[model samples]
Target: MSRTPQAQTRTQTRKVRAAEPPLDVAAWRPAPFLPRSDARDPALIFVIAVLCFLACLTTLFVIAGDRAAGGWAAQLTGEATVIVRASGGETPDAAAARAAEALAGVPGVAEARALEREKAYELVRPWLGDVSDLDDLPVPRLVAVTLDRETPATGEQLTGALKAQGLDAVVDDHSVWLDDIRRAAGVVRWTGAGIFLLIAVAAGAVVAFATRAGLAARRDVVEVLHLAGAEDGYIARLFQLRFAGVAAVAGAVGAAGAALLGALLRLVGGGEGITPALPIAWIDLLAVLPCPLLAAGVAAVAARLTATRLIRDL
Candidate 1:
């Protein structure tokens, strides 16, 4: 009983339709990147941990350096030292009295006091070593002056004003010390920047390696999917989603650990003053908190790109 031509054609069409692969309904549905329970590979976890630790250290160093520099600058600013050269056989006390009396009348002077002999000795002791028996030593009279907060004087103007008086006084404005502080702060900031750049590069390399490993592990599955006519995008997405999940989990853990360490360091209290050692202000912490998210985003993007390119080659 040979079938009619129309019946044969209809049968052949049905057979062809049946032989074709089923539409990937799973792929069409939102394929969420589910993280593997075993995704926390030891090497990858270690790398993330190290990067987080370095970042946290860098944060602490920058904060501490800035605080120290600011404190030093504040203490030194608006203050001046007047050193009076004495006439022959004139005692420092007599010269200091003359200088103090003259400075007291200066319009911008807020408080002027002749540094006591003991204070002068103490100041020089660090550098000159203890010179307790200084009765024969002819050190100039030192007067410490603090300016009114509203009436700051420039270094040159203050120096000229002091010299104009017959007191033979020289003013030291401490600019050199402030300049040193500024340089130190700059060095610390640049060092931290270098460390951060290295961390970023290392992170990218780690992500690339992880993506490659994942692809190799699932090579057979990928081949089977390709044989069944799965689109390249579909296969690449599976890898991308997996890596993104892993990166997110790692980022959270790394960030939390970094925060905890920062808090602990702050509690120890070894800074210049009573403040915490590494006092990261709330705003600073908020600013730094996004770093981990940024790192994770980079990792995810890198993984996606690497996977797509690798699959195309395969």
Candidate 2:
């Protein structure tokens, strides 16, 4: 019991060190249920991302198609065209001008004007390519006819009236052609919706399959956890969180890929035909922003359900 001052100091230091608790590795570290490799696998993420990409693309198409169809239908339904062919004794322009005058006085006719020569040339330039003798090509004259609210002048009636005025004109009601376009747009919108649904289902199935396989792969560990009084919900939550994280990242990547592809399409198409630049709107951005969250939620629900059912059976 007798010690020197230096020895006493050393003894006290040793006591203090001994009184401190030992490092607890288990408390500091979390239980490793799912392997990091399984959680980090890029294959599942890539697959999910691809599915989300397709879903996003179809969604864009659906939105754009609906808007375009409605706009076209509205514009075309109230318009008509009168084409005056060149006659032996008179030019198409003369006949078209005369026809326009006749249409101006007709009931329900709002406005009628012969299309300018330059405008007509521009319209035909796409088909004829670069041509110098465009005027000499005997191109028919075009008259744009706008309809009033009380449209009583039918295409046939306008045509007959022009014929009586010694102008060889044919009337084209845009309503007829636009009706077919609207039908086609409807088909496209429905098709896009169907494709989007299919993609979402496929994504869900993939998540479900992955979750089931993971459960089977780690059955022994799961059973040990179960034996240790770990609740089924606790175990299920692990998988749900892991898969949900994976799906969120994958869905984001997929949405970006879809946006890139859509940009490419709009660039290549040059805002022509059915492919046009998506209009900048809050609704469009809002529609796309939830994709990752939705995918993650779906994955979480699927994983949770699958894990719970399988664990219960075991």
lDDT of 2 by residue, 1-314 (tens): 78899998999999999999998887797658886666536999999998888888778777767777777777777788988887878877787788899998877788999998888888888999999888678788899998875654677777777878878778988867787887988898789878987887888889999999999898999999999999999999999998999999999998888777666665566545334423322244345667899899989998999899999988
RMSD of 2: 6.9
Model 2 regions lying over 4 Å from their true place: 1-21, 25-27, 35-40, 67-71, 83-96, 106-108, 115-142, 148-170, 264-287
Best by TM-score: 1
- Ten residues in a row with the worst lDDT in model 2? 273-282
lDDT of each: 0.73, 0.82
TM-score of each prediction: 0.78, 0.68
lDDT of 1 by residue, 166-248 (tens): 66678887888989888887898899889888887788778888888878877777787789998888877776666666666
RMSD for each model, in Å, please?
7.7, 6.9
- Which pairs, if any, clash in model 2? none
| Model 1: residue 114 alpha-carbon error in angstroms | 1.5
